[model samples]
Target: MHLSKLFENSNKSSPKRTGETRKLFLKKQIFCILYLEEHKTIADLCIPVGVSIPTMTRIMHELMDEGWVTELGTGESRGGRRPVYYGLNPSVRYILGIEMTRKYTRINIFNLQNKAIGDTLQIDIELDNAPGTFIELKNHINQFIKKYKLDKKNILGAGISIPGLIDKKSNISYTYPNLGQKPLDVVFGDLLKIPVYIEHDTKAMALGESWFGLARNRSNVLCLNVGYGVGLGMIMNGELYQGLSGFSGEFGHIQMIPDGELCDCGKIGCLETVASGSAIVAKAKQMIESGTNSIIRKLVGGNTEKIKLPVIIEAAHQGDQFAIELIEESGSYLARGLASLIHLLNPEMIIIGGDIAPAENLILDPIKQKLNKYTISRIRQDASIFISELKEHAVLLGTIPVVMNRIFSDEPYINNIHNFNKS
Candidate 1:
């Protein structure tokens, strides 16, 4: 609620601060009031930004002139005449958020208020590690923007969330078609003709949960994006913790079974082999072929290759023992893997999202049962696992925090953000 973007250790105020500094400070204050917080009156802003009512009013008027803030209807009645509420003018800027997964690419257009502006589009395409893959993906985005009739300049930027080990400093994908280790943003941004930003899909999910869902305002939290492969995102002490190489949260590749099923990551018996959507489908196929007494066999018409996470979840919901057992088995493996995170981070909550999230309690209950059995009581007590409130949209909504964090946060002030942890 401090509202100002100044570094914590810097001088709080300078009446003599001249020219650009004063203007930038004023903009940041107005930005917090109109964008971060709900409808604000001049009085609502004074206390937080340390400005007088008159001064705040002047700054607000200036922001309005710049098309950043707009006057809404009056606030609630309080006996006296109500003050006018100021809100952010959403159309002043828009952001395109793209979430690319193994099976589909989703595009969501968001206004400055972080609210969806149009129908979310899901393009069925595989995010393959092949030549010209990014080009094809970019073309789909072009068609999407044109179909929506969006103006090029009005789009502030586009944020991409992709499945890979993305280096934060270099912005290069260590896991995909970098085409000579070039930053993906450079290649993709050139095609989009706007400033582009990219983040790991899991990290984006964690950001979405933190900003708009179950983990709102939570400092120490873990977010697991369980889809084709499992990915983990850690918010340690109030900041998203990207490891030194920005590849910290590789949840899927953790070795869970030694010398077991081979993983796409070129490893054997990784956690992904047991808990990911692909893993669930693969296991379900084997069970169907083995004459497992389950509804999934009938739902897919005995086509083992047609089995997917959704069908398995549907069969489980119908009380099919085989489907239930398979999900329980996956959850148990996931819980076993997460026990390590609980020990290392001691996070307050763990938010799970992606395709498996819709299974809700059917999938979550087993994971909790495993945690209860395996995790130390003290460590487990600190964290409560929650299904993501944003559900399948978590990855798409996550693009908001990723781009916003980079856009608004000063690099120096980012470090100044305190990490609040429990002992």
Candidate 2:
């Protein structure tokens, strides 16, 4: 049976089905809310769900009878009877989350409760937009499902957090434009024989923060992904702000220096050129080759080619002046970019995530110190900066909301259900 049947109402006739469609829509919203934050009483659910007490109670009962929800004991009593707490049934459905970078891919299966069914599988597949890349990714995903013995019918959809310029409306990835004649999502959906939703890597991280990390319930946030390259994800007015072309958060490409190093995006002075992981490595290699003294030389056994961001961070941890200076320089450059973001957006929080996040105070202290000079005191104080605790898993966890939003966002619930059934 198609997964759409899960949302279908039993009565689908003239007067009998007058409010069935509205019930179906309400059912979708209730599921999404429960999926996001579990264990809500009927009273707790009515306001956000915009339904009355009896209506919510009836819907909750229906969802429980359908095996989508479960009663989890009772909550505190105000005066009379204690309210029953309800939540999603962990085994009712599953979601597949995939995080793909230029160098590797990670996949995991999650139940409705957002708990992993098994260990996350990491496959080393160089993502160069080659047809073979997708082929290999499909093979790995297929094998992973088999290893877990999960029924394909029970898995709702797959969410991919990939590095690319993707238009969610068109489901096309401009970065991998030559991979297929059809849209990238269609290509993957065909290969996997399931619905697939794709999102840009940085924005995916932002979604992760919104749903699972520091940005949750916050109105305005800026998530900076500082790894292989600098990337930005913005949550404005409690929504992920994908710009006119779904490319709004290209924070890395914004010009920071007038005539600095050329970025891979074919522009001069992109912020990533000076403040990203790649930039940190580039500076380290240059200085090492030029005979600058540092503990990094000892760490890498005098091989500059082996230098990377983590090594420099390690050197700084050991009190190496050169490494400390490199991080400080990058932090200062990052501050310059952030100052502009503060003045323009006035976000409530700034989350620093990705490979360089482990640098911790080494990176935070500098950015904070420099902000004092670069930003207005009141404005800077309004935006609290934090390092993401979600760490390596941020992008992966993000795919959950991306898939959920795609399923629940727009079109009439019945039409969406019918479309899924047809697909």
Candidate 3:
């Protein structure tokens, strides 16, 4: 299906007949239409959004009055008068995306077209300190908005993506035990005062890739996030498959060895314990402690405590034999896990994303080599594997679609605004 058509069909709903309905209603329509066909006529929008010609006419007038949309030229008619074309103004609103991982947080601002309008900020904020962590996050977002001089009223919403289990129904992150009694959205939204949306970091990345990156126009895609942990995000039949409680893609905890290395989740032989960045660093530390003597020792310069994933990747890139060995082993383990996923899902494509993907061919080559041997040749031939186009920023970009879905889906936010205006 055409990408724009998919977006438009996804938003087939009633016309919100209210003056105070969040401008997002119009914003979403404009975004969907522009993204789908680069332009749309009022009649085209009326049929898709389930509104009559008159309602669409009024909405378009309001959009123009608010400066959120503008009238382009006219479309040639089949048997009637030429119809006027409309498009999103592209300058009236923006979206902010926050990608949170176990190791770092990145914030970005984007225009209606999903183009980065300003700088992206990265910070190291540990999940262990929940209260202080979001406090710092709030400060960062406030500063970002101030720095860009963006109007909060014109901001659509902020989407936050975090690693680990997320209860989208409750807007709470269950993995951050430190947060104790509060839902993440409640806390973050109170501070931001605008709508705040939260999503599993991996799923967000998958959505990001599906909407604007490598997975575009492809259904049944698998996104692997190789970061501080390993995660999987599945897009099946052109929709994100968040099975049973929105925790489907917990690939990191999949058992690789019956009683192998221990994981922070208290499970034995979990894939992440041996394949994630943290796992790689732990294995490297253990090897160094065993007195295996290599350039990694000198790279750390006797401070074994400072060994990190990037340092190891760099060393491997620089031809450090031991580092290469570590990455190869991790890649092989990852391949074993992916082999199982391929057999079960039969995805059309598998995209490797997250921080570790930057290692590029160094890591991907081993994964491909191992999969060639592990997966059934038939399934292997059907599936193609490639690095993610959005890389580390996929989660943040994914937030755009998340918020768009929320606004356009059958939800109370838009309904309440419409109802309020009617009353």
Candidate 4:
């Protein structure tokens, strides 16, 4: 499905013209440039996006008048008139980003310049109950707006990132059983009375990295989300490469040990079962249950229910032999999975994200050791592997780009900005 049609204004009475479309395209192009750079003159934007000087002037004037862009002093004159630099007026517009996982949901508010404006709120949410879940999310947004004293009019829209297969064309999440097969945007848009954008959590992370993190200039980067379940997000040729049906990055479900551990996805011996945080915790519990002497028993204080990823990481940091072994084992399995990814995608960089990345050197070292042993020397030498720069906030920061693309479509850019200002 064409993205343009999803956001097409149903009230338009006439067909769009090439000139109008070009103007709209320029608007988006300029916004992206300003977002990436702190300040840029009209001449800088014109050269890169391939627009004329007169066209840039018109677009800049419209943006400035609509309170979306601001003049940021003059630039060096190259034997000509000094060019005025312009930047996105971050305070004039805001975006709400929500990143949902099985254990919790993280929410953040960012402005046009992508600077976070308020304190991020992390809440525990149960995905099993859809109605209560959305209600809680709605309340969180309302409270956040109230806390920040933000005018609803200034909000561009909200972006929701969920783990699982997302049909971007339909905005539906197939893995979220409670959401059924309905498009998430349609449901959330109706409830919030604002344009809502939905994407796979890992894909959103990849976009986040591209826009504001280490992968900014690098294409063909792979973002691996190591959470309750491992997932992959691919950035190929400078675009988020969501495969057919938008469920491309299911690397976790890739079979590693056939007929071994059972996966929640109804698959046996999937990579996630052996490599994810849950897998580590599960292995620790099994070892403790078998009367093995380990530091995890003392760390959890004999309470199996309290065992978590952070606890295991902390124990490993404190030189707990058993905890270290568990993490190293999981890291080995993760490297085995990544080795296959290296052979297939030939990505320039591989980033490990999500909650498990905080393990830092302990997990990273084992992963690198196994990769050196398993992968071809050529691939290992070229592809750099590291933890995510955004750390735990990658998915939350990703929401800004997603919401902007959905709400600020080709036509009616000014109108949308005005609507936001008036709200």
Pick out the ten consecutive residues of candidate 2 with the lowest summed lDDT. Answer: 8-17
TM-scores, in order shown?
A: 0.89, 0.87, 0.85, 0.87
Models sorted by TM-score, best on top: 1, 2, 4, 3
**Candidate 1: RMSD over Cα atoms?**
4.7
Write out the backbone clash pairs for model 2. Answer: none
| Candidate 4 residue spans exceeding 4 A from truth | 1-32, 45-62, 80-82, 407-423
Regions of model 1 farther than 4 Å from truth = 1-17, 47-55, 76-81, 129-132, 411-423
Report how far off residue 421 is in candidate 4 (Å).
30
Among the numbered candidates, top lDDT falls to 2
TM-score of 2: 0.87
Cα lDDT tens digits, model 2, 359-401, are: 8888989999999999998899999999898987899999998
Give all candidate RMSDs, comma-separated. 4.7, 5.3, 6.6, 5.8
Candidate 3 collision pairs: 4-36
